[model samples]
Target: MTCRVLLADDHAVIRAGVRAMIQDIDDFTIVGEAEDGKETVEMARELEPDIILLDISMKKVSGLEALQALNRHSPECKVLILSMHTGPEVVLEALQKGAHGYLLKDAAAFELRLALEAVRRGDRYLSSAIVQPVIEQAVSKVNSNAEHTLTQRQLEILRLITRGESTRSIANGLGLSVKTVEAHRAQIMKRLQIHDVPGLVLYAVREGIISPDD
Candidate 1:
């Protein structure tokens, strides 16, 4: 079966390079091109492409933002993020936002073919260059089991603490005594092996306990 693809990137040169690479693969065709996230989402809805090769950085809206929109509006169209960034946070965020695959921009042309084929076959794909780091992060998180270790109350307090809430305020908000709130905070730090507020915040973000926006 022919696979229809939509290319979304701000740079024409990058788009052209990807277009050239896709041309080498059999049964794959570029159905549309979008220069930004908004256009990408719009084209995706209009074209209903089998796959989208999307860049993370764009002018109007970011690829991550587009992924969220596509998740809600174009659930069937697979999105493969084509980005220069190899950060674990970025890759994880894209996947969490509903991307089917994540490919580094510097990947070999053949890797692109492999990624497309994998996503087309209803499987998730990650660039070989990034797979190790992603796995290591996952392993680290699994070893910690930070999410499962904390009780719901502890998790709630941790979220509030990460948001810069003071013990007095937390106690007031949760209708607990000031001393009780302090004890909970101390326990949270000890359990996570974090010595300070900033460290706790970083751990919270990394463990997916709280988003940066939260």
Candidate 2:
């Protein structure tokens, strides 16, 4: 099946280049383009593409803002953030806000297709050039000393959560009650001081508890 894509960037040249690259791929079709964040959000809502290739900086609205808007308005459409920013904060923020992948602007053309395929399979992707450092930095910032706080059971539950398992599925897999699983999740969140599921997933990735692709 061909995946419908929306290319959103402030630079027309970048959009054109991306379009050329994607046009060569049999499984992807460029359905629309947006020059700024506001337009990106509007087009995303209208087009409802299978994937959105989004830039971080844009006029009128920022990509982060647009990402949040898309999550609220069109949660079914996956978002892959294409940006120049390599800072862990930016990467983590995008992931936490529901981005399916993060690609650096300088990544090779081949990596774009790889990212698309990975995200299309419901897996997360980070550009090869930045993944290691990004994870290291993110984990350090989240408190390197805190890893010991989680018990083995909590770690197992956290991994299941990051893998997108439903609460009941997790309980069944672990042979635990739903209430027991939920209680474990709550303790995991409280122990880590991470409130949202995405935040927990991010922490799991950064701490090497779960692969983004898992």
Candidate 3:
């Protein structure tokens, strides 16, 4: 059976290249293409594609956020992240957040094919190059003196708050009550040992959760 795919990439050239590479494959069909994360989610919801190829970088919402949304809204649809970022943390975080596969952008198309096929079968797929590093990073975290802990919801709250979003804005964005948003913000600061808004933003930036320009 062929897998229907929703292709998402910010760059028109990259999207075209992907279409050219995979359109001829007997088992893959291009059901839709999206240029940004919002469009990606819309296509996923509208087309109900079997798999979505998500690019990490995009204009509005990042692919990571879109993956989280898809996982929550369309649990059956598999998400495969194709990114240029090779950070072990990014790969591990994406996998943990429900991405079925993580393949670097530089990987061969054969590897892309393999990843999609593997994830289609309900198995997780990580590129061979980053597999060891991801594993080691996980192991090191377990063996470290630092305690790493945060729920997915908590991480989402942290991201928004650090970006200087007001509580009401965050509540509206995440569909939560303002009070609940404030509670999450408090919990985040307490956990991170940050008492100041500026400190929270700085921590978010240092942790790669947000950029300085964000």
Candidate 4:
């Protein structure tokens, strides 16, 4: 069955473009649409799509806020942040707040489909093109001992692994080597001083990353 999808964006043209691209994918179908975060949340509740694609700077509530609300009301519904922001901090913040995936607004249609599928399968999806810088940022944060020491890529990989993706699967999905993914995992665990999977999950939850509600 095709994965039911909801699109929430302030721009009609962008939404139209995304819909046009998604139409080419056989495994996805747009079941609902909303123009802003508030409406996005409402339609999401009513439509109950398997995934929700949101734009961050909506007119009413921001996508970040909408993501949190959707996760709260319908934890089964996954959220993908498809915004123009490419900064490491912005992506990490969105993921930390409750987004299941992140992608650039200019990303290709196939990438959008991939993001939706990954998130729907209880995994995470981030634009692979952006993962390296995100990882570097995370490592820096960890070294700095910041309040939430995570980069967007590390958070993405961590969420995917915690959601049950294997090292090879994560590498394939993110376009990285299995060794590289394992290295990142080891580094994350070491920096956080987490010994195992349960500890990792607890740390993620405690730090406001992915939630059990997610």
lDDT, candidates in the order shown = 0.84, 0.86, 0.79, 0.80
lDDT string for model 2 (133-185, tens) is 66666656665565546989999999988766668888999999999999998
TM-score top scorer: 2
Local accuracy of candidate 1 as per-residue lDDT tens digits, 106-162: 999889998899888765677877765764564455445445378788999998876
lDDT at residue 116 of model 2 (Cα atoms): 90
TM-score of each prediction: 0.67, 0.74, 0.66, 0.70
Q: If ranked by lDDT, best first, what sequence of candidates would result? A: 2, 1, 4, 3
Question: By TM-score, how accurate is candidate 1?
Answer: 0.67
**Cα lDDT for residue 44, candidate 1:** 93
Model 4: ten consecutive residues of lowest lDDT? 139-148
Clashes of each: 0, 0, 0, 0
Candidate 3: tens digits of C-alpha lDDT, residues 1-214 = 8899999999988888888878766699889999999899988889999999999899999998998889888888889898989898898778777787788888777887888777776656778888667655654554234344668898898877655466777899999998998898788878877665544544555566666445
lDDT of 3 at 189: 74
Better model by lDDT, 2 or 4? Answer: 2
Q: How would you encode candidate 4's per-residue C-alpha lDDT over 109-185 as one tens digit per residue?
A: 77877787777776667787766555556545553343547678899998887665868889999999989998899
